[model samples]
Target: MVKTARPRGRPPKDADPAPMEDVLQAALHSFATHGFNGVSVRTLNRELGVSHNLLHQRYGSKEGIWRTAVDWGFGQLTEKLSAADDESAPPLDRLRTFIRTFIHVSAEHPELLRLMNIEGGEPSDRLDYISERFIEPQMARFQQIWDELAKRGETKDVPQEVMYFMITSGGGAMFASRALTERLFTSRPLEPEHYAAYADQFTDLIMGALKD
Candidate 1:
């Protein structure tokens, strides 16, 4: 053997690298709290404890990082929605499942709603990109499901866009208004149990209202 040349320049570090998901999650939180124009690569690197060069190397630019972060956040929601839509159940059950799932996802990832709200507050390329890449597709899918339910006589004949807005905005309110939610419910914490109970009640309320 040639002694392996001492494995090149130096020994491997014992520290494990951060996963892409973790990076994206951190970016999501940062970008959601501070809009794209408000955040800097250096700030993100400092918060993440990584080099600024890493963000540039991986995403090429701040815009690229914003795009990736938005994609990652919405990708998670899309996966959950797709799974709920695919479940082999009655139309009404599927509708309820979708509503509950949406609320649960919003509660679990409040950053998603925050980021969306921030983007929606101002007109920019970032907002347009997110709308085109994530929001439109998600809305289309939900519209298809809603239309199916209506055709099956399971749900009321409501416009797709109206129902979509009702479900997303209404279900996301608890998560999107953290300060208000905490202040209003000062006696108790907004724990997972609270979210679960809310999801159940919200699903019932929406489904009841959507009945023919």
Candidate 2:
């Protein structure tokens, strides 16, 4: 009897356990670029050089990966916002810190904004999940801060929802509109200094408007 050789090309399944964080990062980028329906397990597997079985095992399904990716992205933003909003600081200072931190994070992770834009343009379960899990909670926290400022008469009476929308959508545009920003500033590439300057200007503009 002749002994048959085992498969040479594919390694044993246990040989390479998937690095979950790396998978999430890749999934985040893919979902951000392609939205929910545009991405597939096969595509992700090919891109990450992992098996579809691994992704399924880790996330359960494509929707699971989408949910996880959205959670991961917003989790990062929430942490940054929480750190920036120091309760020990004065309200205005805390507000400034929050705005600057938000702009900085937006610049660093433009993919977050892109993904949100894509989700906002469509009506789907993925969008509903993001709204419940991320958007509503963050907006509530922001409204709480504004309410405190209003009680102290530091800020004028403005619609909290409008202000929240302006802060996120307007600030996001600075980083999201890369082509327009680059064309507008043809002499220089957008760097850290540019983002810093924009943050300062954005804070000043919002503060001024709120006071007025």
After superposing all C-alphas onto the true structure, candidate 1 shows an RMSD in angstroms of: 3.9
Steric clash pairs (candidate 2)? none
lDDT of each: 0.81, 0.81
TM-score of each: 0.84, 0.83
Show model 2 residue runs off by greater than 4 Å: 1-18, 183-189
The true-versus-predicted C-alpha distance at residue 115 of model 2, in Å, is 1.3
Runs with alpha carbons beyond 4 Å of true place in candidate 1: 1-17, 187-189
Please provide, for model 2 over 140-207, each residue's C-alpha lDDT reduced to its tens digit, 9 standing for 90 to 100.
77777777898999988998768876888788775777778788975254576677777788889998
**Predictions: Cα RMSD each:** 3.9, 4.1
Candidate 1 on 35-84: residue-level lDDT in tens?
88789999988777776578888899988888898888998888888887
Candidate 1 vs. true structure, TM-score:
0.84
Residue 143 local lDDT, model 1: 68
